[model samples]
Target: MKDFNLSYGHWDLYHKALKDEQRHDEKVQEAIKNNLAHLLSEESIIMTNGEGMARLPVRSMDEYKLRYGSNDSSQVGQGDGSSAVGDTIGKLPAQSQGKGEGAGDQPGVNYYEANVSLDDIEAHLFKDLELPFLEKKENGNEGEVEEFIYRDIRKSGVMGNLDKKRTLFSAMKRNTIKGTPGIYPITRDDLRFKTWEDVRKPESRAVVFALMDTSGSMGAFEKYIARSFFFWMKRFLETKYASVKIIYIAHHTQARVCDEEEFFSKGESGGTICSSVYEKALEMIEESYSPKLYNLYPVHFSDGDNLSSDNNKCVELVKKLTALSTLFSYGEINPYYRQSTLMKVYEQIKNEKNRFFIFKDKQDIYPALKHFFSVKEKATS
Candidate 1:
């Protein structure tokens, strides 16, 4: 008979058994391996003592090796979506005992176990990681929750030190009740003081979306800047908002969706129809997200060098997107030496309110992001 405790590490029992026996047992070794594999197969494995000590399972350690490497040095290090996939090994759900040991002299039943995969575990965990920091406050009348990205840091302060400081101050204050009677006139028993009030500050929630053209003319520099911009903006939005969902669309003759990895690394080399991207984004917003419910913002990064007569369609697309989103911005990453005709069409939109932005280089991204989230003077003051 084999005994196993989930609290202890897998190798712990194995090594102990081996040291005691001094001889190798092939069957026992195989059983241990199978036990570990079964543990790995379990989804949502949480450690009793919560911390980074949790085991995150990946499809296979071999898969991780292929993407990164077998060596610890080959870790993807740190980035926005680096730790996205993994298997989490932890405790099993509580089970209740059956009423009778044997079913009225009938045979006993053994329940079969279902093995879970790394992919299944990752998909399960991703839902929790989606904006874990922000707490939701339900809005009155509407079912929609008022989402804020702010954190209440004061709620987790050191109370022990605060108590000691308060006690010392109280004793000092009592000694001076009769007006600055210096020296240790106050007794420790007379010391009575209140605890410090916690501090909390309001944080802003702003979401900025970047739609970049990955076509050939943009060059390596442009692509790099675009990836960095998205990464930075994602980090910033995370601080202020309860959630941030980044959608990447690469359009040439038409627009199709891409994940973060494909969006940053994929290169461009096809005819341009800028309107296709806008249309798809509009559909996505309508299907998954509503304008008033979310802090909606859309930014399009493209070269001013679009097809000669497609400007009208582009303007129509802008109008459609602006209607759906809170603020729509067009950032033209002009790298080629061509006429800036793209700017002209967007400029004619009549309404100057949050419509277009044309930039010459990468340095403009910061300012452009600021402008995108920047409130008007009346709104700011």
Candidate 2:
């Protein structure tokens, strides 16, 4: 009899290649996160109905590879009959340098485009944002719906719920009883299927208020930007809440409730009175959605075209809304560098409960979302 032990020295060296690959993947993810502000508003990404890949420009890590020098002896290259290995084949065309110089003195940046699917981008972007401030309050109208949960096994059931493990065991038992000791011939009595019990579960309740400025001052571009913000926010919210109730509100000189179709496409021509929408949102919150029953999120988007007379009223109403909300956000879509009467007033209230953003162009859309829904803590719960 003999007892022995084996050992493999320096076994960790074999895993170096895998470690390098993991590091490269981490770098790619970091680059995507850094460039997400611009990538979020890109037309290609926004228009990808539900499936597609997004090409993101990321700087490649400087990799060192062994190669021969330009004047090395080992050379075998053919192009224009005067080229050798590691030498320029011909005059390389100038890259974006407008035909002025023979060649730029500075070195080129090492950038490579990485193709990531929509799901990947979503995973990266949303990982940093969360809905932690959502607190479960008392007096909930939490309705329960019937759901089928598989639990038991039965002989007579649908094919979709057939239990293979149980059926095989039954077949084996029948075979042993018949003195065959095999499970080849499975009978009707040996077949087993899974059964489900109907039960009720409580669903989450939340309300989202999407307010937009439809005044004459808000052109097609401003409205489009607002719509884009809501579109992504809605998708993000749907994943968090089970029953999400969205209240679409469009306001010019007055505020009115409308359907989803009219909320994004409807256009109005009138003066700007931003306080009207704020007041209307506050009224709706009190009349229907109680803060104790539903988590409240009222997001408002305008061009900062609020009238001077209504700025005072807007600030007062905003203070009240922020107090009764799970997450409150206000966005100002100002394309041109114009003076904003409302933005100036709203910035003074340094209440950390509410979030405010000013977007000049499409590139600012994603950043605005990150700012509005960004949680201070690390955990989403």
Candidate 3:
């Protein structure tokens, strides 16, 4: 054993195996992409305690095993035992199905669980979505503010704005020009600093009004679907716009402004007054979020179980709101409440199909969201 000659072939094989494993993992993610709607649903989220990390059940690779082929058709116990067609040869213990306790040595079908973030789930859900009619409006001086933009570099500035690299380069150049070999002297002029210009930048701000009907008729399933839609909608808005203000309004018999937690979780028992919520949202918009200053989005979620009397009022309010809003989206979340009075009212007022959506189940959340945010290309004359 004087000298041991080791080849680097094992290293290449190891890296190749790692690449293959990564590819397999990517494929698994791609497979799970289609199931994002289910993953982002209320049921899946409730299982994870509303946490960001959700354990998603994924299909595992099929396990293969090499077996020896037998020449004889029947080998009874490797000897002389024959079994009937309906007779049980052996009994195998039942395996646990779900997230249960205890572990066993029994071999069974393998499954993979992927831990994915809510953001990732949203990204998948809203991958094809975009805010429509996001045209920049020239709102007077109210929208135009003096913003400090770093556009110019100067020889003089405050200590905080010193361009150290540029200053150093200037000092080095001056030193080189003066033929100073020993000392690297920095002159007053050589002290270059970054300068900022007070430019009047027009800021495009967006205000999202998330209205939900928390009436008595809205059961757990109804509330859950509404919450899921709002949650994803808020997340999608934040991702798309830099300056976005989200206002949550929850209504039962009466409409009231509430925080996100209260908006989604509060269980209010009363009659459904759909117009009240729209009125409150409109009032808020008129008072604070002006259409000229902000890109308004009035997104309402309901079970389509509003009072028959309130339908006309709701329609009128929606028309008024749509006049000011950049985009108005109304989502009806009841499967049984099909062709409902509230929906019928909305249909009459809706300018386009994408403006109004009917979500029957959790699977419809993604498509509804896409429909809400999608900008339809105007047909050329």
Candidate achieving the largest TM-score? 2
- Residue by residue across 1-381, what tens digits does model 2's lDDT show? 157755322222222344355555676688777777766766575555435556766565555798766663334446675666787654434443355557656577766676765665677777666564666567656645567999888889999988988898999888898898876798899889999999987765778899999999988788878887877777676655556789999999999999977886668989999889888988988899988888888889999988899999999988889888887788999878876989999899876677888889988878888788776653333
TM-score of every prediction relative to native: 0.47, 0.68, 0.67
Residue pairs with clashing backbones, model 3: none
Q: What's the lDDT for all of these models?
A: 0.53, 0.77, 0.74
Return the lDDT, model 1, position 66: 41
What is residue 72's positional error in candidate 1, in angstroms?
68
Candidate 1: C-alpha lDDT: 0.53
How displaced is residue 154 in candidate 1, in Å?
16
Ranking according to lDDT, highest score first: 2, 3, 1
Tell me the tens digit of each residue's lDDT in model 3 across 8-31.
322211233343455545644675
Model 1 ranges off by over 4 Å: 1-208, 335-338, 377-381
Minimal lDDT window, size 10, model 3: 7-16
TM-score of 3: 0.67
Stretches of candidate 3 off by over 4 Å are 1-17, 42-50, 61-110, 140-203, 379-381
Error of 2 at 379 (Å): 18
**Candidate 1 per-residue lDDT over residues 1-381, each given as its tens digit:** 256644222342233333433222333333334344233222243211111122422221111134433563323234455344563433322233344665554434422223333333333222222221122222421233253343322323444433445455666676678676443554646444333444434332333456777766667666655665565455455544444567778887678888867876668687777777888888887887666445557778777667768888888888877776666777766655454677877888864345566555555655555555555443332
